[model samples]
Target chain A: MFSELLGIAIIFGATVLLAIPLGLYLATVYRGDKSWSDFLAPLERLLFRAGGIDARRGMSWQQHLMALLTINLVWFLFAMLILCTQGVLPLNPDANPSMSPDLAFNTAISFLVNCNLQHYSGESGLSYLSQVVVIMFLQFVSAATGMAACVVVFNALKEGTNEKLGNFYDYFVKSLTRVLLPIALLVALVLVFQGTPMTFAGKQPLITLQGDTTAVSRGPVAAMVAIKELGTNGGGFFGANSAHPLENPTYLTNMVENFALVLIPIAMVFALGFYLKRRRLSYMVFGVMTAGFLLLLAPTVYYEMQGNPAIAQMGTDMQLGAMEGKEIRLGAAASAYWGITNTIISCGSVNSMHDSHMPISGMSEMLGMMTNAFYGGVGVGFLNFFVFVIIAVFISGLMVGRTPELLGKKIEAREMKIAIIVALLHPLMILGGTAMAAHLYVSNPTEYAGWLANPGYHGFSEMLYEYTSAAANNGSGFEGLGDNTPFWNISTGVVLLLSRFLPVIGPVAIAGLLARKKYTPESAGTLRVDTATFGLMVFFVIWIIAALAFFPALALGPLAEHFSLY
Target chain B: MKNNFASAFRLTLALLVLCCGVYPALVWGAALLAPGQGQGVQVSHKGRLVGFENVGQKFDWPEYFNSRPSAVGYAADGSGGSNKGPSNPEYLAEVNTHVAAFRQQNPSVKPGQVPVEMVTASGSGLDPHLSPAGAYAQVERVARLRGLPAERVRALVDARVQQPIFVLLGPSKVNVLQLNLALDSLSGR
Candidate 1:
């Protein structure tokens, strides 16, 4: 327990230690690079004149986000092209060819949107040409696009005229060349140390198996996993995914991979809170997310630690954690840890199966998915969390007869409506999807229910949770449900599309509105969002929203699983 | 708050550049100057350095201890499944394939038993290191077929297993590729 406590403290300490430096750097970049601007001035003017847009004026937040969305849309089309024609491309080892449209769209929207929810394994489905030209390259720039959005918004929020949100292209390029590419390379090297396969070779030596010598598949996976995780993109290079020894070579490597998955998402809030000069504000976001994150983590760890008693009946002696749907070396601690971290960060990679977790553990993972999407990542989570804070603060402000303000800007009617919609989207998706799954389709029953593994209500709950995870861009699965089927694929795809765009619109709207507002300097009576008080307030708001929407769904699934197993 | 917030964000962005860009350039340069490896980006073989042997796809020939339980990684380019469980219908079927294969390779061996790790794949399906027990279990069969003594084979295993930082962090294991290479020389294959 002391060690665990110490581990938690160390984790938090590292987060803050790294965040302070990182946050300060982000602050500087957002203030704009005058030297670079001067150098690019002529080109910017030329391009703007050619493109028939005003070069001198700053883009409104709406206009800026629109540009981002438009680029993303185009990127989606480009990614789809690679996926569709992958089979015909050279460097095709498998002779495997062209992706199905649905799969192609899911993957394209995934990477282009930076969600990277993969339905296809890389080594087989994609040719080397497809892998390099499409996935790897998209990874570099798509990552930049997301980071640039936040940087632009951060600048707009701070800049005096409420005019210059900064140039989109410059920020995107810098984010790619300066941030994503370099970090990805370093991480890739570290991953190689952790035993990720780094090769363009045909395959490793063949071991004779089943009277046949099977040639193994090999490609540039180490490089990809490095960027995929760092960029918070969750697509796996192969089907066995991260648990593959090559993907995660050792337990130490596993820990590092998990660390890679989350380091940025947690760090970003400090980036936001600190750069805003409300150290307390960043602290508050930090505290709230930590509280929310840890709440989710504890139960997952406990349930995973509790493990499967049925396995215990065999006298095999499984550990006490949520052993179901998890790796033995990793155990429940690590699985639960990944579950919580992935959902919080809005990164969808899974090291363990979630569908098999004990009921309580499952809910906690769900709650992590629900994370009000707080400063969530490059695009979605943070904006969602900010909106939640807006409404929570706004509601409280109204009740107390004080104006609701977040980060020195008034949280007015439009912002509250947007937050409400964004906050409400998942519950609607979860409930609607669950209801449809239960009322309409019945999956071939899987055999492992202590409760969650069984049929009927628990089964319905599983469907709901799966949709919730998918919709949330939180890819941790219940594993009890077979979702590779068309119903799930289609439904998840639909939910994914809606979920992807909805939260985005809300944030862009909020940024636009906020961009239009003149600065309201802090006064003594104004609500302070930086202190522990604000932390608790934000924490309360997050809890209330999660409880209201998810409690029943969680109860039917993980809650029931817990009692039946116990 | 305004001023402070901007400063923190700037600091973060700068550090990101430093960590992501500058640090990597330094590492890449170091690799170039270093005595061995990864300088050209591929982990290659001794002679042609034709391709990187370091990662991906296990070559499952009879003599070598297979590296990982790959999904679609081998020649098929389509992922596969062992599909065995404590009670799977295909469980016995898959195990029999492993059992039969091992038995064929070691005609002197008994028929029914095989080590579990040789059959089961890790979650990632791309694991390169064999578990210690998995490697040790293969020693008797490998030694007998290659006409090498058990002690020598054990020595090879010991040589392949990576070293530890402390008692706990890393596990000792045989590198499947290196072990197989040594086995080939001994067998004159």
Candidate 2:
């Protein structure tokens, strides 16, 4: 127990320690100040020249969105084309077939939105060419897209009313050359040294000690797995994800991968502190996010370590605690810790099968995505939290009978409307999608019998989890859902698309509008957002809005399962 | 929009080369320094390749410590978990069946003494290690099957027990494959 606690503490402590320096470095890179990574400036210049992009040209908020969308559209089409014809492409040593059109649509949109909601298993579903060219490529660019958009918001938040923020291509290229590529390379090398396969070789046929012939899957997994966590893309190279021995290999590798999961998201918060010169405000945001993270994390770790009561009813020693869908090397505590981190950060990678977690733990996982703002995915996480901050600022301002002026910009009806819509959009899509799925399942049980792997409340959870994971732009799932069909693929694909862009547009628009407003200096009358009082207010607003909206849905799924089981 | 499209198209192509082509190739080059040349570390026994050192294989024979139940039947080519929710009746019944079978196989052990990991399936369907308690549970049955003393088998299990790194991270576990191979040498199989 002590070791398990220490294991999680070490992972969390190391991530925070690493995030601080990374945050400072991120601010430097985005600010275009000189640093150690300046050697990559030549490469960035070459790429910009090749693309005919003037890196010095500044962009308005609308221009930033346009560049982001156009590039994303191009990538989506490219991904679709490759996915549909991967069988004939090069590097398919296993000779996997092409995806059907619906699957291709789902997959392309999933990766493009930076939500790797894979309906198909990796080893069989994709050839090695698709794995590298489409999946891994999208993982890098999509995360950069989010980070670049975040920098736009950061520029807008600076103390000036200026139409010209910064060049979209500048932030985009620097995100790749400075932030993601260097870190990904470092992590990939570590994984390779730890024995994760980085070769182009296909599956190796082996004869077991028991004289049975079987084959082990191999690929350039080390490279893909690194960014899969680092960028918060969370697409696994194999069906079991990080649970696979070769993919993760050891406890040390698990720590590395887990550290990568939260590093950038947490760093972006500190980067906000440095970028905005609002260190107190950033610390308050970090504090609230950590408190919410631990709230969701504690129940999951406790429940997972308690062993499944249903299994405990049987005559067996469950000292290992709920080992059904967990690795022995990782143990239950670490897996529980990962479940919360992945869900909260919207990384959506799993080292354990969430479908088999104790009921309360499953609820905690869903709640993490439901809130979807606590240390969220890379750059987009803070954007999601930004909406909540706006809403909280407005609500608290109303209660105190004062105009909500955030960083000297007034929070008016227009900003409040956008914030509310963006906040409400999460629950609407999740609940609406799950309701539609539930209705479909209930109306004709026999027709969609294969949709669920388990019966009753747990079955409901599988459907709810899929939509929540999608709507949050989170890629993890309750794998028991037979979700590769046209119904699921198309529905979740639409959810992924809508959820990814609109939230981004709304936040950037609000920030842009506020940037154009007259900058009023701080005074005694201004409600200080950096104070502990305001932080608690924001925390309450998040729980009241995000958590309360999902309570009834919770009652029907994981909560129902918890009550019945325990 | 046209200007944006032109730049977007060019940038996308440029990034593909850098991200997919250059990056993975660099990692692959560095992997040459790793053990097994980054193809995965394989375990060989008596001049024959048995399996990967990290991937679990089936060992149903009475003389060997049986590996954990696998949802995919230990198929290394594909991996997955049972994904059975904790309260699913059918899944629970399956666990009970495993418990019953384990008790029947190891008759000297009490009904409640079986380690849960012995019955439950792992997430990867290829978990290579068992908790130290899981390995110790099978000592009696394996010793009886091999005509060896229980203490000798216990000592062998003890020798195979791998402590968590720095004794402060992860769980103490025994790799079933390595332990079984050591047992084979002990019994002169």
Candidate 3:
């Protein structure tokens, strides 16, 4: 128990310690300031020239949005094409078949939106070529896309009067080359050293001691695992995700991967501090996010360590904790911590199956996705949390009978409208899609019989978790549910696209609109968001909104499961 | 708009080359310097490849250390958990049956002493290792079955205990496959 607690403490300590310097470095990289990676400037410039891109040309928020959407559309089409035609593509030593049109649509949109909610397993479902050219390609670009969007908002915040934000292409390219690439390279090497396979070799035919011949699929896993965690994109190289031995391998890799998952998201918050030159405000944001994260982590870890009371009643010992749906090598504490980090950062990689967790642990996982703003995904984590900040500032401003202004810019109706749409869109899509699934299940039980793997309350969680994962742009699943069906494919795909883009589009648009407003200097009357009081207020606002939005849906699912367990 | 689209497409092509082709190739090159050169380290017995050191295998014999229960029968092709929630009655029944089987195998040991990992299926049904306590609980059973002294078997379990990486990640565990192989040597089999 002491070691488990110590491990959790080390992981958190390492994340914060590494992220501070990384945040400052990323801020410098985005601003095109003189930095250690200046040597790569020549190559960046050449690529810009080759693509007919002028690095000096800034874009309005509309232009930035168009460029982001256009590039995304192109990538979407590319992914869909590759996925639908993977059967004929080279590197398919296993001769895996192409995906159906619906599955392809889900997969393409899923990856493009940075969700990576795979309806298909990488080892058997996707060919090796598709794994590299389609899946891994999307991992980098999708992550880069989010980082680019956030940097645009950072530019808006930094120079409040600027008519144009920085170039999206520049940010995208630099994010890949300067930030993600270096980190991925180092981490991938470490993973390979620790035993994660980097081979393109086909499945190895092995004879088990039981005399049955088993084929173990191997791939360029180390590379995928590296970016998957570094970018907070939790798509795995195998069906079992990081739980697969070849994907995670050892406890060292597990800790390293967990740290990598949260590093960029936390750093982005600190990057906000460095860019805005408001270190105190960034710390305040970090404090609230950390508080929410710890609150979720505490119960899940304690409950998981306590094991299941129901299992104990059946004469099984509770010693060694809840090993159901968890890697014993990771133990309960790391698994619970992984659950929190994965959900909080929108990194959906699982060392343990969230489906088998104690009911309240499941609720914490859902809450992490529902809130979707505690040190969010790569660049977009802060952007999503920034929405809550806007609401808190507005609500508190109205309560105190003062105009709601952020960093001197007034939070007008337009900004509020966009923020509300972005914030509420998460629950709307999650609950709406879940409701649709339930209706389908009820109306046509036979056709949708295999849709849910488990029946009753846990079955409802599978469906709810799927939509919540998609709507949050989080790709983790309960996994017990048979979710690769056409209905799930199309519905969750739509939710993935909507949930991913609107949060980004809404936040960036608000930032753009605010940047254009005349800067009002700070005064005694201004509500300082940098203070601890305002941070606590923001925390309450996040909790209140999340609880109200998700409590009923949760009540029917995990909450009911919690009571039933007793 | 056309120019922007063209630029975006070109950049995508470039990035695909960098991320997919060059990046993976670079890592693949670096992996050649690592042990096993990206292929997993295989555990061999008398010049015959037994299994990958990291991967879990089936060990159902009473004389050998048993691996954690598997959902997919320890099939590496499809690794996963039972995905059963704690409240699910059917899952509880399955666990009860496992407990009954465990009790039947080792009647001398108390029911409460059986570790959770020993009965519950791992997330990766192919878990190759067991917690030190899990292995120690079964030490007397293996000792009696193999006609070895209980002290010797306990010493073997202690010897097989592997520390968590840097003692800051995961828990102390014993590789079931490795320990069983050592047991085979100890028994002169």
The best candidate by DockQ is 2
Among the numbered candidates, top lDDT falls to: 2
Docking class for candidate 2: high
Fnat of each prediction, in sequence: 0.09, 0.88, 0.68
Ranking by TM-score, best first? 2, 3, 1
Give residue A172's error in model 1 in angstroms: 2.8
State, as a TM-score between 0 and 1, how close model 2 is to the true structure. 0.99
How well is each residue in A441-552 modelled by candidate 3, as lDDT tens digits? 9898898888776778888999999999998888999988898988899999999988888898999999899989988889999989999999999999889886578899
Off by over 4 Å in 2: none
- What DockQ score does model 3 reach against the true complex? 0.72
**lDDT per residue, candidate 2, B41-148, as tens digits?**
989999999999889998888889999999999999899999999889999999999999998888877866889899999999999998998888899999998999
Candidate 3 local Cα displacement, residue B131, angstroms: 1.0
Q: Give me the displacement of residue A518 in model 3, in angstroms.
A: 1.1
Candidate 3's C-alpha runs over 4 A off are none
Choose 1 or 2, whichever is better by TM-score: 2
Per-candidate clashes, comma-separated: 77, 0, 2
Q: Tens-digit lDDT track for model 1 on A1-566?
A: 22323333444466557656766656555555343324534543443343344433567666666666666655566678778987876767667779888777766766665665555666566776666656765666566676777666566556354755766655665565445665677677777655455545555444332233454555666667777777777666665456554555555656666666666666667668666665666776777777777777777676666555544333222322333333434434655666677767766677765544556766776777766464365545666676677777887787778888765777787877887988888788878887777656544233322213435445655676677776777555554465555566677778877887777767766876776687788798787766787667767777788666777777776666566656
